[model samples]
Target: MKIKIISSHKILYQENIISIIAPGYHGYFQILKNHTPFISILKNGCLKLESKNVKKKIKIEGGLLQVKKNLIVIIL
Candidate 1:
């Protein structure tokens, strides 16, 4: 599925990915293709993005996330 990670000021990462780990307000969650739609507040932690079939991790102070139309958009 396609994914775009950003912040209030700039885009962080945009690409196709197999999975992602995000720090949610309640806790951390993982998203994969065809995952259920959701909107959640985020927390400070490392975000793991499995892009090009490789897992890459990025840390953020946290913000929000929305999953819709098979797309995952994360805001930091």
Candidate 2:
């Protein structure tokens, strides 16, 4: 799946990821390839992305997340 992290100034990160776990307004959730479309308000926490053997974590204050098709867009 494709993932893009965007901030006010510029694009922070954009790449293909196998899965992602993010902090939602109510709790945390995970998204994977071919997952159903989703949209949610994010909370202040960490966002985790994983692909193959690599894993990455990013801290975000709060934002919006949109998942559609095989793409995930995160705005912080």
Candidate 3:
């Protein structure tokens, strides 16, 4: 899936990925390519993204997560 995260500060990330792991308000969750459309709120925690080239980790404050049409968009 293509994961994109935007914040008031800047674009945290925008890249192609095999998976995206985020800290959901309830708990941790993973989103893969072709993930069903959905939206959620994330509490303070970390986000993990994996790709062919490298794996990434980023800590986030509260934010919004949206999945649609094989795309994951996050905004803080």
Candidate 4:
């Protein structure tokens, strides 16, 4: 799946990821390949992204996340 993290000033991240873990308003949630489409409110926390050969974590203040067609978009 593909994931993009955008902020008001710039695009923070855009890459193909195997999976991702994000901080949702209710709790934390994970998204993997071919996951169902949905939207959620993000809380101030960390976003973890994983790929075949890479793993990363990003700190976010808060944002909105949308998942559709194997694309994950997060706007801060």
Q: Name model 1 segments beyond 4 Å from true.
A: none
For model 1, residues 1-76, the per-residue Cα lDDT tens digits are 8988887788878988988888888888898888888998888898888877588988888778899988988877
Q: Pull out the clashing pairs in model 1.
A: none
**Model 3: residues with Cα > 4 Å off, grouped in runs:** none
| C-alpha TM-scores of all predictions | 0.88, 0.96, 0.92, 0.96
RMSD of each: 1.2, 0.7, 1.0, 0.7
- Which one wins by TM-score: 2 or 3? 2
Task: Give the worst 10-residue stretch by lDDT in candidate 4.
Answer: 4-13
Model 1, residue 39: what's the lDDT? Answer: 95
Q: Candidate 4: lDDT over CA atoms?
A: 0.95
Of the candidates numbered 1 and 2, which has the greater lDDT value? 2
lDDT of 3 by residue, 21-71 (tens): 899989999998888889999999999889999998999888999999988
Candidate 1 root-mean-square deviation in Å: 1.2
| Colliding residue pairs in candidate 2 | none
Model 2 misplaced regions, further than 4 Å = none
Q: Write the per-residue lDDT of candidate 2 for residues 27-58, one digit (tens) a residue.
A: 99999889899999999999999988889999
Estimate the overall C-alpha local distance difference test score of candidate 1.
0.86
Clashes counted in candidate 1 amount to: 0
lDDT of 4 by residue, 1-76 (tens): 9998998899889999999999999999999999898999999999999999999999999999999999999999
